[model samples]
Target: MTNPYKSYLSIGEKLDKSKFILATFHLQSENQPPARNASASDAGGFDQTAGGVAAESSVGTWTDVSLQEKILWENLRGRVVELDEKASIIRIAYPLELFEPGNIPQFLSSIAGNVFGLSEVSALRLMDIELPEVYVRSFPGPFLGIDGIRKITGISDRPFLGSIIKPKLGLSAQEHIAASMEVYDSGIDLVKDDENLTSQTFNNFYTRVDEGTKRMKEAGYLKEGRQKIYAYNITASYEEMLKRAEYVVDRGGNCLMMDVLTAGFASVCGIRNRNFGKIIHAHRAMHAAFTRSKQYGISMLVIAKLARLAGVDSLHTGLLPAVFTRDTCLTW
Candidate 1:
């Protein structure tokens, strides 16, 4: 038999002491097949498939269990420990009630037999049920979330209006900042540097931030506290980004923005974990490579969860009721 998550069980009980371990699960089994002659050095190796060791076998299948909501079985840290057992191939236990109720079934179906336990059909009919962390774990959402954003900007009811300073390919720093000013003064809620505006020879980031943020601030005062602007600090490196962020704050900029996709996951996570005193606006630029294919690409829902975990205060989720239309606003 296989122990997919034994060590995680002991770690789970002591997770409070170390935030590093997201979640853990304990799998018990009975009348299980004996462990094959696998080498200890091959514990985490990937070549086990070519070593001729037989994989997990299933006994039964799922039938017709149905549920209204989707189910999710998350492994917060994405690691599992194992435990020895006695008839069942393996019995897994996880935290109950923390999932979104939208991805559970698919998850159960995936781990069936050969890996964790349940058989194929049995996995399919698992129904929508919440599991305990002993089985899985989810990460922390934005330190300052959507509600925090509204509070920070002092806006409520409708969505926070936003736009990007564009023509990123051709605009000079002055032109870009000037365009930003137009959006700021128009009483729009937010303005951002399109992802491409990062320290291009045509537009130095320092010069643009100095000019754009200054104008936006003036416009904010004239709006009688109605609208606000956020300048993106998508500079070259982490330190540079942080430096630009500080500069923006020093100039009294209210919010900050970034193209999370362009910067990479760790960058987003680092920015989110900081105490920047501003709403972290995340742009999903370059997301198509991972989300364009329905079957092959990752689900937007999953990306959203990871973004939240990485600390994005707000994100650009295509326009409301305008995803597949012709007009810009009609099909964003």
Candidate 2:
């Protein structure tokens, strides 16, 4: 009996770095004995499970394909470039043509989506991904990057201090303003809406922007001419986010905070591309659900990279750092 998806395994294939993405996954197999129907030479545990990942993620189904389908699969399937048995790591080289350029959501949906649910592996994590230079540059990253943030706050050579308006909820819009003003008066440089506080009746979105922005201006101008950032949360439906952003700009707010995970990457990109002259701050509120486990789901580093590609200026800490680069592997 021949292996059904053996063609997906190409152990020593040399990929064009520019035309492919290298993804590293921490893989685990059920490690059971070979089925009775398998060939006598079958090492039907880890190798087959690893190959299943490439097949499912790319083009192959569990069932065998016809000769005609094999011709089409030749160029489309993700090729397993390296598999380490002891360390339980598999590296796959995926063709750039397999992904939609400049679309993070679709790219993730393809490689990181369906493969996680497969029964062959009990534990899996999307440990790391290396991007081609062209793919990295395809999206407009960071509307107001580090220099812009430094320029905004008039701070150099030191970290800017900030806080959230706590008693995170049940604070009326006016009370929320008072609490934020206290933080600003104490010389904190940034204040943001907590991730869960958005558009609630007790603290309505419009009032928060209208009054909060006014108070920020007073606090900023009066306190040694320092600029205070009101990173107002605009996480909502895409259309609603735009509407809220307009309201923030109209109210003279200098920054916007988004629960990027909750807002969705596409919406984050939508807000960034609008370029309403405000810095975008990312809050990964529910990221732990996807990032905490060392053996499951996507890594926080991957999330940060996606956030940067989606155009966030500053991100929540655990947490927060710039995207992974070639030098990053050295540090890891």
Candidate 3:
């Protein structure tokens, strides 16, 4: 029988079906052949002719296919649009019906699952995605965007100045509070806990938020009507993360920070749904493992987009080289 994917040979045909995801895959030389077949099967590679009378009677024609089989095949398969041997890139059009609107976990599993483990692929990266308008509109993105952040921090003319607390782990709760107050007094607009700085033994999350905000108010920072944002790192288990965020909000904290990569995009989206009325600062703590390689893993740009879609107010983009290592720079 004719290849089912042959029906969607042109860009116009793919575009006509509005609900679909456009995914780009990078394939290494060792697995190119199988990767091609796997990608074809990933979306719709099932042999309609196998174990049936249609296999023997209409082996070379598409006419014998039933309407139900055609519809099912189309819904299950991803259409291959471009495959470049020299450059090693494969672009596939995944049906929008394959994903559920507003569900990131399911979306990830559909577009990003299992393909990496295929024996044919030595390395595979999900470089980019072209999400349809309906899918894009289904999620509530950053509530506080760049303009909103600028308005909240009262810094519109230039870049907002911020710093991470040094010696990331050992500081006591009081020490953390002192350092934050000093930064706020020094005219820094924001201060954030380092990505690894969670509820450590010495620097408890609640104590830091409680004393830190108190010190900010006492420093006359709030008295002058200028807001100084303290992004308390709330990266923990799903339940613990929510509790930490709630604690920050209850104590009048202005911002919440999370290691978006380690905590998972779903966690960030969950936090956004809480409507806590605080800025969400996203730290790409462990993104390098999946984003550093040029020929393997995803890109930081895609990660940033996902974070924004998950509703982060401010995302670390590696603008400051001094803050990130050489390896981290590669991911950015």
Q: What are the root-mean-square deviations of the candidates from the true structure over C-alphas?
A: 12.6, 4.4, 6.6
Poorly placed runs, candidate 1 (over 4 Å) = 1-140, 222-227, 320-332
Q: Kindly give the stretch of ten consecutive residues in candidate 3 with the minimal lDDT sum.
A: 49-58
Candidate 1: 10-residue stretch with minimal lDDT:
50-59
lDDT of 3 at 108: 73
Query: Candidate 3, residues 1-332: lDDT per residue as tens digits?
Result: 33343454333343544666777767663523321333444332211111111111112132345544766755555665566646766666776776778888777766666555544456667788788788888787888788877776677889888887788889999997788788877888889999899998898888888898788777755432367888999999999999999998887778899999899989999999899878999999888888878777778777877787888888876653685666566434
Local distance difference test, per candidate? 0.49, 0.81, 0.71
Flag regions of model 2 displaced more than 4 Å: 32-36, 67-71, 221-226, 318-332
Best by TM-score: 2
lDDT of each residue in 120-178, candidate 2, tens digit only: 77888988889998998988799778888887778888988878777889999999989
Query: After best superposition, candidate 3 residue 30: deviation in angstroms?
Result: 2.5
Candidate order by TM-score, decreasing, is: 2, 3, 1
2 or 3: which has the higher TM-score?
2
Arranged by lDDT, best first: 2, 3, 1
